[model samples]
Target: MRTVQYELMRPGELLAEKERFSVAYLPVGPLEWHGPHMPFGTDPLDAQAVARGVAQKIGGVVFPTLYCGTERARTPQELQCMGFEEEDLYVVGMDVPANPVKSCYFPEEAFGMILREYLLQIVEQGFRLVVIVNGHGASGQLATGERLAREFTHNTPATVLFTRAMQKLEEGDQRLGHANISETAMQMYISGDSVDLSQLPPREVPLKTCDWGIADALEFQGLGNAAHTVEQDPRDATAQLGRRYVENGVQRISDQVLAAYAELEPRQGTKA
Candidate 1:
């Protein structure tokens, strides 16, 4: 009912919104293949939905989701631990093989520059409080965003908040991962029948065995078995469960955003 989408609103309407909240939400994610069962826009979709939800709770303008993101590459040896061959193709974010269409990812340095510019533009648009709702969790992606948030806040008058759309759940809750249950459920809630968990094989088929899907139970050189990286069965996820996660994430992110927004100095109107 209420509109927070920045691209959808007129300049006058956006100015009124800025006058009221001076907050802007950027949903950042990459255009990577989630799985054959799911859509490629899964990550950004999740971020966009949550961004709108949080913006509704706390007044703000939600930008059309940013499809650019960063990621880390896993060498042949590393992927071997995940049941791959000894030496072969390279894998990028989320244990996905970087063959022809590896995932839409930029180098970390380039990604940092891209995000830095986005933050600068948001601040330039006269938004005093900026919220970056990240959906992709590649280690490099996370670092780049955090570094930019700190830099932007320290260098500019505007305050920036970088947070994950799939925020951490309570202790013992299911861990989120690439195309995992948590994500699938969120997509189910957001896109309805667009994301068919039915496309996934029967319950007997293991996710780790798949070629382009989830990589459950990963083990790194220094890191032990990281089951949380890809935990839970998507089939077990329901639309209701999806709603619960989405709602909880919006609540948590909104709480953090509101508390921080409150501490910033009162807005002085949009820039001329």
Candidate 2:
């Protein structure tokens, strides 16, 4: 059990643990709709909570959460009702958008470059493994993440591990989506008061509702829907459930992270 640690290593601490197990865990989330009940940062926050618990359990460093994504747009109707001639502003994690208009959105390549730069710096600081947890749950992000992980590891001794890689080490079920039970519950646990369950948007509506269906299907032009927000029946979520989800998810990640560390240990001439 590698002493279950995280990024508390200061300058002196770093020197103290030159041979200590080192890993950096980052959480990736986007600012977007999460129904009316949950806050916009639900996805990333949920992932962060899970990552922190895992770091505590497996001796890993938890880095700050990244909220940027490809592109984000508010539906015309939501904008109208919110009384916004433009996109209303919201904060996902620590960053407040310049305008309500999705500013964090960018090309996948650009996002990858940002991630690569961040990891490269960490590797230079002597970290042996970098674990990134993407709560965005987009298949494109996951696919791209895999490629980035490979490229990152190919270029350096530092290894990149994404949340999905954990599934291979554990039999447990973990989903990658928003507003689902897992996400809603996790939000409830993370910030119960901030979650306005009373204002939850209506569910049980036809899937073909004008918002996403036949008729004037609105393609967000060239921008992707990375920051676009939507929610499930988050009002139905409970803090108890949120805690359970976080606990379970963290365990899954910790299990996989430990396995990865073990597999890479021999190459580094270290033992766990």
Candidate 3:
């Protein structure tokens, strides 16, 4: 009912709220490039908004979002998407940044460990339900959260759930993309002042899908001709569409959180 952000609440407030409903929402995303119109923090920001909405609906506490997740290694095709010729690029360790693409990535193992520790801390704080909502579509990042949730819940009283806001939408309602229609619209709704649709590239960038398995390997090997940087077109995105996305996403996520909380109610009663 009050501020759902864990960091903003007083110790007494948190303790009282924990007794009322012991659910913690953790939002995770990457700081990757989201075209010129949207800010680089779009993923986590959108995720945090969704988490906040869910927390407000279910009386849960939302944690500070984790922005370090797996990102695609830049390849020749990716270079082209940013308007750089293949010959203009040079490999710099695991990155090939000819364009300004800001993404914070943690190795798969390290991310899993970080998630595990975060969950442990939340459980230690007496929370019985943990909801992990990710905004990034990278398989490695998504998998890390889901895997950690399964492993942690197997050995603890906490019931951890790993899911993405987009995953809750119907297939027809979903249009998951990188800085494209869905994300652009959602960001516009969440932080309208920050969004500048005029900055979108002049031409529409064609969408290219990749096999996650080979996509990462090829990028690492510098052999993929796929555009891993940008996907879909955001020229038609509007704040109204974004509001629709937020409304639908919040309802779906809140419903799931409520269901999880109901299931954990019995265990919560046993805790004290």
Among these predicted structures, which one has the highest TM-score?
1
Note each model's CA RMSD in angstroms.
3.6, 8.2, 5.7
lDDT of 1 by residue, 82-181 (tens): 5565466666765455323556788999988888888888899978889999988778999988888887777787888999998656756644656777
| Cα TM-score per model | 0.88, 0.69, 0.79
lDDT scores of the candidates, listed in order: 0.77, 0.57, 0.70
lDDT, residue 52, model 3: 92
Show model 3 residue runs off by greater than 4 Å.
72-98, 203-232, 266-272
Judged by whole-model lDDT over C-alpha atoms, candidate 1 comes out at: 0.77
Model 2 CA lDDT for position 125: 71
Please name the candidate that would achieve the greatest lDDT relative to the true structure: 1
| Model 1 clashing residue pairs (backbone) | none
Q: Residue 88 of candidate 2: its Cα lDDT?
A: 50
Candidate 3 TM-score versus the reference: 0.79
Residue 169, model 3: lDDT of 50
The clash count for each model shown is 0, 11, 0
Q: In model 1, where do residues sit more than 4 Å from their true spots?
A: 75-80, 95-101, 216-231, 266-272
Off by over 4 Å in 2: 1-9, 71-103, 164-176, 201-232, 269-272
